[model samples]
Target: MRTATVSIGVSNRHVHLSPKHLEMLFGKDYSLAEVKDLGQPGQFAAQETVSLVGPKGIVEGVRVLGPIRKSTQVEISRTDSFRLGIKAPVKESGDLAGTPGCMLVGPAGTVSLSEGVIIAVRHIHMSPKEAKQLGYKDCDRVSVLVEGERELCFHSVIVRVHPDFRLEMHIDTDEANASMLATGDQVKILGRTQDALDLVG
Candidate 1:
């Protein structure tokens, strides 16, 4: 409990747009920023946020993806959600576990795909040095406080200990809002922290 590990979770909104929709928003000035190598098989690993031609909207950053079997997701920060006038819950991306989805109205037409911008939350990978110092393994579960209503505890949050992932907690847009947590909010692992240990679900 001597502050060996300090992890923070940052959540973003995900909205799955259609192929045509993707091109429409970013066809003109879409550029790839970073490609994250997810150890997935046979698929290319790249994430891009496109620049829509606009003084029309107050939003930027488009995360691009290859063809998928399901919906196209657009991740928005809490601030971004407010700017877009999208009334969505600030739940964890995984919190909307088995929900249908939501839609977005663009300048072109209404892009209706899903109901909520929450889905497929993943673990933030960490370096071995960090993991060893924290006494964590590649898939250790940490209890995250679920925001709102009840003082909920999210159990089994996976830890992907590795050298590549930077130290951070990764949550979807939903979680950030429900917890009313913003950028630079301090969070830690839920064990023997005294102040937070008792609240760990």
Candidate 2:
């Protein structure tokens, strides 16, 4: 078994609202801030709270992504949009080419997507000693079986073996739920032809 852990990044966000919707939410005075890389056209500055006015119902507190286009997004809830004022329930950020997502948990919710939030999933960083021992190659689909008070098997996890990558597995909240897991908890790795033997990290 490989003695390493992997971590993955996962986030959920809504699509940016259109111009018409922007006019409805933030009055037409606001404009979109031009961003680079994954920034989609019509991407606007979200002022924290807005309404998602969908045909079905509305989701309140919808973060209005400025510079509205055709598809507007309501990030939080299928219900929030309905009770408040929104169009769709929950539109995935993937619908838009360049919009991103971030959530702040404490008392007041004030947070934005990180610089790399929109790009790809976060992975475990490794070192040469770690990689050679684990027999992991970049882009390898590796499955890890977790045994704790409860037993689970996580399958098809991507093993990113890099010279600089440290041994660890990355999982998101959603993925954690699938295995009923927790951080710092240990899992058993089963497979591969690598020969570095270490029972613990």
Candidate 3:
């Protein structure tokens, strides 16, 4: 099966902080310094990194992404979750309800979170125009076919459409390794949800 092709971007473990958490971890009046622009519009990787302390272990040098959000969230891979001994559910960004939490240690200070860690679900970010062209809508489920040395099909990929979004599929490190996919690689959209069948057909 073949359909539209989307560029792939491998996402590493990272944290997004709210202003208050940023202040508590970095320092009062501290602001994130952009290291580089990301594929998604307006989102960038900060020069700063922090250590995540979980019940079982600590993972260091986790990049911080900017700009700051309304709430702090940690996105890790399932392998990292096992290493840290946290059962982080696979969730979409900003869906932190009932998620796990961990302590974040920065240069100036350390902050403990009550809850907000997750194994980010695989998703595609695209603009409305691109979504319409591909016969996809926001929150629609789809599958993707990755071809090459490590061929595989990724299911339950969420479609996220926004005016500011660029057309790209985001997968965590583990998924990337399993499929031997890296940033700038392309994946073919195989199928979408049943309701959108006719549209893709």
Candidate 4:
């Protein structure tokens, strides 16, 4: 069977801010300065960054991505959570229920968030047309095979399809280092669940 391919994008720890939180963190009328465009349409990395304060330690210079979201969220790696002394769940982006909380230090002020930190789950961002071409739907889970010095198969990868998204697979820094994967590396989609295993086997 012909498999779908996606470019890998290793995402470092970043923050997505809500409108209210943005004002509270920055100034009353501050706007994010676009640094670079992301894989997804209209999404960019802002010049702004913030410091995250946790029980055990503080993580500084966490890049803030733009444009602003409806709800604020902090995406960290498993190792970051350990360093911060938070037990953040590996959750899909924007699903912040029952997650840990942390203080975000910005230029204007510091905001204490009740809950929003997460260790982002590995996911593929694709357009609706791309999803249809691959015979997949939003929320469908699949596995990815990355061939390299450290060949690895990533399982339970969530599919997120939207009109605005481009074809890309997002993984944390830790995962990328473990598999010797880097930006621009290609990964093959190996169907869902058992079929995925069969592909690897």
Candidate 5:
């Protein structure tokens, strides 16, 4: 079996704003203040925050991730979904069609979205060179083996390869807690889904 080690990035509930939405939420000509750079290139945690208001309740102080995207998106955990009474589907970034939307409250104003909320699917971000070295390609499903007291294999993890990406496996807070994983913790990619199917066949 082919195996490769990769670092983990545990993601918390956050929001990505589009240029238009950012202006609506923060005010015209406003820009995001970068507090910290993320594992992925050109991505950062902005100092600003916004409140997400749903049918049942409101989740406040949700950090905004930067730089701005073409469209705004909200990535929350399953627990967060229940608290907000939103049935957000597990989807890849930018795959927001037919998903739920909510009201975003900011200091300057508020924006009501038609659809843009999702529970981001766990995925690995790797550069093309790294992907080639790992024998994987973009959008490939693979299994990852975690080691520790709660050691287990994570299945159906999608691979995202790009020139600007750095090698890192991103999981939500819930998944990280279940496996007791932290940022920079190393995990092994066992093989692609086809490899497992071939073995079974």
Candidate 6:
């Protein structure tokens, strides 16, 4: 069986703003300032931060990821959703059709989104060559073996393949904490469903 080791990327709550929303939140024609580069190519953590206002409470200083997207999306953990009183569905990124929305407060203005909040599913980002080498394709779902004090297998991890993607598995803070995983930690890719079952057996 084809196997490979991938690095972990622990994702915290972040927001991806559309150009229009970016302008509204920051100012007209404003651009995001790159504070740090992320694992993925051409993605960075912006210097700006915003507060999310929900029915129950407010979460402040949520980092903004760059560059801008076609639509604004808010990615939070299930625990954060509970704290904010929003019933956000677990979905892949960019699948924000009927998810919950919240009030976003920025230094210049506020945006009341009608919909665009989700708890992002776990995924792995890899280049096409890497995916081929590991016998994986884009959109394929597989299980991963993480070793530590909280050793466990992560199932249904979606594979994302692109020319520019770096080899890294992205998991939310909740998942990371549950598995006692940190960024740069290594995990074993156990191929498809049956392969994972075989390993467990």
| Model 4: per-residue Cα lDDT over 77-147, one tens digit each | 99999899999999999899999899999999989999999999999998998999898889988888888
Winner by lDDT: 5
Give the TM-scores of the predictions, in the order they appear.
Answer: 0.46, 0.40, 0.94, 0.96, 0.97, 0.97
lDDT per residue (tens digit) for residues 1-201 in model 6: 387899999999999999999988999989999999999989999999999999998999999999999999999999999899999999999999989999999999999999999999999998988988888899999899998798999988999999989899999999999999999999998888666777768
lDDT of 2 by residue, 1-201 (tens): 354544332222333555554444445554544432222222344554543343355434434445455554335433333443333322223343444333322122223332112222323444657656777666555556666655766555555654544555555445556666755555655644121123332
lDDT value for model 1 = 0.49
> Any idea how many clashes model 1 has?
25
- Give the 10-residue window scoring lowest on summed lDDT in candidate 3: 192-201
Model-by-model lDDT, in order? 0.49, 0.44, 0.91, 0.92, 0.94, 0.94
Model 1: per-residue Cα lDDT over 92-196, one tens digit each: 433544443334444344455445453344354567887777666776666555444434555456777656566666665566666666545555556332345
lDDT for model 3 comes to: 0.91
The segments of candidate 6 whose C-alpha lies over 4 angstroms from its true place after superposition are 198-201
User: Once all C-alphas are superposed, what RMSD does model 5 give against the true structure?
Assistant: 1.3
Candidate 5, residues 106-144, lDDT tens digits: the string is: 999999999999999999998999988888899999988
Model 6, 61: alpha-carbon shift in Å?
Answer: 0.0
Model 2 misplacement above 4 A: 1-124, 192-201
Q: How many clashing residue pairs appear in each of the predictions shown? A: 25, 36, 0, 0, 0, 0
Error of 1 at 187 (Å): 1.4
